[model samples]
Target chain A: MTRKWLRWMPAVAVPAVIAAAALAGSLPASAGDPLPAKTPAEVLALVAQHSAPSLSGTLEQTSRIGLPELPQAGPSSGSGGAASVLELLSGPHTTRVFLDGPSNVRVQVLDRFAERNAVRSGDQVWLYSSKDNTAMHLTLPADAGHTKDFGHYKHRDTGMHGVMPTPEELAGRLIAAADPTTEVAVHPEVNVAGRAAYNLVITPRTEGTLIGSVAVAVDGESGLPLSVELKARGQEEPAFKLAFTSLSLEAPDASLFAFSPPPGATVKEIEVPAHGTGHWGKGHWPKHGTESGVVPDAEDPAPVAPDAVPPDAVEPDAVAPDYRDPNGALARPTVTGTGWESVVEFPASPASAEADAMLSNDPLLQQAAVAVPGGRLFSTAVVNVLFTDDGRVFAGSVPAERLLTAAAAR
Target chain B: MPSREVPDREVPNRALPIREVAGTDGAADVGTAEPPSDRSSSGWPLLASELAVLFRRRRTWAMMLALAAVPVLMAIAVRASSAVPPGRGPAFLDRITQNGLFVGVTAMLVCVPLFLPLTVGVVAGDTIAGEAGLGTLRYLLVAPAGRVRLLLVKYAGAAGFCIVAPLVVALAGAGIGAALFPVGPVTLLSGDVITPEEAVVRLVLVAAYLTVSLLGLSAVGLFLSTLTDVPVGAMAATIVISVVSQVLGELPQLEWLHPWLFSHYWFGFADLLRQPIAWDAFGDNALLQAGYIAVFGALAYGRFVTKDILS
Candidate 1:
């Protein structure tokens, strides 16, 4: 009997040892964050001076925006699938991003059982959906900045935090627009992707704004933005987050930039006019974007027209030209108030019925919006858009009451 | 020798009664319950006997046939029907018509979620309990197999099933797919084309990955088998764990628990089909499986060595 129990020693010991090792592995590295002290301004400079021109990393994007739970995989997911802009917004997605500069960039949305890849090399862009085995090719005009031309992807893909803009681009916009109503401070150093980073927090000093603060982690060594997190006013959890889970500063294989549709793939060639003549140009809105700037991507920062905002003359309130919305049926889209509290107001469009129908007919709007006294308010953690009975639309990163007040005052 | 069905069960078990697994006979203690002396007998011959007993069972053959039918049925359906609209069905379903090689991949995908785990659960869960249930377990303990040796042989037999099941599905998939669809170059997920030889190599790699993925669950099943005398209970519990792990994996709320889930890397084998073949997930998955094996293998050892064997 003693011998029988003696044999049990290894069984118990082996598992116990493994458990101990696993416990050690799961604990975050206990080393102190090793970085010299830096002020908020210093961190801002770190970002401006930062240019890791070539790097490959995997980024995870997750949102708790309170959108209804949509089935993640459906028949439609196969064709447009997770790459569909709305689909991208709803769930957690892992994207592998490889950038060799403005000329060569490949972003792969790694969906289960399928992948949707957008690879841009020189003037050519290839969008391939592995699910359906279809590829779309577009050749850019010589004059349009490839960086700006990629905006068409975000332009059509309005909503969900500037459609895959790197943390650098998003954080750059926030820092550029910092004003008297903005409070920038450096939190204690934190670690991101195994790199020490200065956590720069940008708080909105103004009241009545949905934005609580935006925190960006700047890599201490490379000065690159490693992660960006946005929190709503009352929410303890970040409403939207994008961060690199793994990163490598080395340039990815040059061959990854080149894409040729496989032999059996059904490839479609998308036609674009040369340079400035096409709507795909930076200064122009892609055809669909002009139809509805109501996309939630329009809420924060300035509109898609960053250059349209005068270089040195940003209104103290940070109001620039409102985003393009040809279908809004209202010309003269304007902003009222200032700082983070600004509300974009569009007067009742001439075609009220069409605009009203557009609002009422939208499935997302109908599902997300709750009827108010005179309008329906569609609210997310970051943006609230109100559609009044008279076909006027008011939207901002402010409370629904603010939008209603603006509508009533109008 | 009333138990003629078990072949050479009695003498070997009595010849090498390990101190740990020597069973107390409630029905008939015919042989001396002596300390283990034939430790050297716990070698290749014992494992060979274990495997022969396993593979010779009609149930094992039936399960193998059922697994092989998955890809055959899938290929025949796709071939009989009009082209499945590109985005309408299971992931690689549409690709199968374009390239016969995809039938193996798609079949593996479909089976990994349920069928493969179910079969693995049966075989692994049957390890000790099936012997115990048949009343041969006690005899085998006295027959020549020490407790540790017998446990090793049982696990090896289950592990053997792990490799063979996926290979069966993959090879059967290839045969039927080639017969029905056109065989040619394969288009990888990265859109790179590879010769048929390379594609076959990739399929084998996929099979290898799947074998690793299921090995962890096999360990879990083996441990569960030792917990109960009824094989069916152990089998159900083992299969349930696989399903639950997959369900938890899909929940975004449990994102923290995901990296630890065994099923987390089940589909990552497709990374093998990428252009340069992303080895990161493969490495992570192998490490995770190894961890599972160590934890459960030890747990099974601890339980089986200490437990009283009455059958």
Candidate 2:
């Protein structure tokens, strides 16, 4: 019996070893491997290096800014109501972005059944929405005056505050926000868009911000941001997420940077107002002037005929005076706070008895409007609109109390 | 072992039937009982029979009636109201007073979320399991209707309900809306106005789009139906899944799951309001629905073909 058992031991041991080898082969090699670690400073440097001028990819963006239920009628005007911010942020939107150098860029925002493309080639930008079959041609203002001043003015006046940030933009802002007030660290490696990525977590040290931390996933090889996530204070899950579902390092085709109105499309020409010289306490405001500021692009041979102007075309110089009431009361807007927490206040309008009576009579409007100390407050996720009893309208990305304070200020 | 047991059980039944027939004239009795050229063997006949049986049911008529009544009630309510509430409902709701045809579009919006999905779920869930519960499925299978063919017939019946339910709502809404409100050129979401003829075409497209949206839920209900013999259980499960998905889709925290959820693109029909017709979401919705159909349809096929028809 001992001899027989010894003879079978070799066979049993060999099969056992083979089974162990097979199981090992089936297991992932990187299962227990540690992620590559780097310092916060190194991560920041990598982010700066990868902020390339030319690149293109498909971006998937989603936002949940904790918005209240909006009234069904939707925003009232072209500028959109307060709920428009919620609408823009709450849903999933796919944007095909091409930045073949910053000056020539195209962003195609795709909706379920519609497509809207904003293509900027050289000085001309064409916005075409396939749904309405409408094409808007905007002639960008000429690169006149100080580029830096104009850049600053554009950055402040673009009304991009509180809007959901793209991956690259959010990455850049996170880097800029890095200071003594922020605790920066490099997180473990994770997969994003099918590529290995390292997350750079930026946590605010300040107590006032609603944001707890922002995590940016940077591609391991290319160093470009693949995704950005933001978590509000006391929340386990990120409140906002924007990421590239797929990306290509190769430069997008040059043809995609150009736009032409399709056949039967109603094309409308818009003249972008130039940055005027008027400065109200360091902030530039558009001055009411007759200067066309329409620097004809040398590439395009078609001259803009004066008669071709639409009846409602906003004269560039006539922008400033429009802010004034019939009584010549100028409602100059002023900015307060800095960076992400900035707020803009528009001068209060003198309340009219007729407007007061109308507000009192409309029960639906009364129900919709939130009563404050002096007026009503309409709030959404990222923006708040305050309508004072004295007829002043102040809108910003701040809370109701902040807007009220701005309204009450002398 | 289970496969072997299935044949063992079936063999005894087959022998008993033959023995009983053998006591009489074996050949004639066998031939009459199992006809070589049964009409049910054909696909079209089976589908027609299945659809007829489905429509004959009281529940089928009741569901369709409930679906059709929604638009009528909505039109009456809107017309009865003294003031046209702005920014209160869907984009088309605000414009219903301008053109009554908008009532049809608004009705589609109201139904697509919950009501239409619930109706589709009930019909699809009942399709296969209902037969099984009544002990008729075994007879149908033995009629040599072919398992695949019978499944397809059931699906077709469910698909029929899906298409008809929305059409009823849209058509009734349009007729009532046109009667109560002014019908004229329609202004699309793009703010560009189009002729009344074009608007009618759009309304048709809206109805078609809504029907396609239900394909995912129908597939889910069909798959669930295959999992159990209880029709009511399957129906409830299908509806519960839809509501759960919608709820999950609304959560900001689960933003990553939105695209994969069936309910995510249900609202894509709104893109039809655009002038040139937004094809991105339209195409995406179709592709997503097709994906769900392929997945769940395969699951149902895989399970049903080999399933022991103990009932």
- A1-410 in candidate 1: lDDT tens per residue? 56657657777787688779879977766647479999999999998888776889988877766665555532123533112434545567677888786577777767666676777787777777676677777777666563332323332212122345567656666676677878999998777788888999988887777788888999999998998887878899887777888899988999998888987777877766443332231112111112443222322222221211112224332222223332332365677877788777766665434545654666654666689988878677777777788777776787778888888886
lDDT of each: 0.71, 0.61
Candidate 2 lDDT over B127-195, as tens digits, reads 778778876565555443455666777898898887888888888889999999998877665444678
Model 2's number of clashes is 10
Q: Could you give the interface RMSD of each candidate, to one decimal?
A: 4.0, 14.5
The candidate that wins on TM-score is: 1
Model 1 clash pairs?
A77-A81, B12-B143, B12-B144, B13-B142, B13-B143, B13-B144, B14-B142, B14-B143, B16-B144
- Evaluate model 2 with DockQ and give the value: 0.06
- Candidate 2 per-residue lDDT, tens place, A158-237, comes to 21212223576556545666666568888877667667788888776655445567789988777788898877667776
**TM-score for candidate 2:** 0.54
Alpha carbon deviation, residue A310, candidate 1 (Å): 17
What level of docking quality does candidate 1 show? acceptable
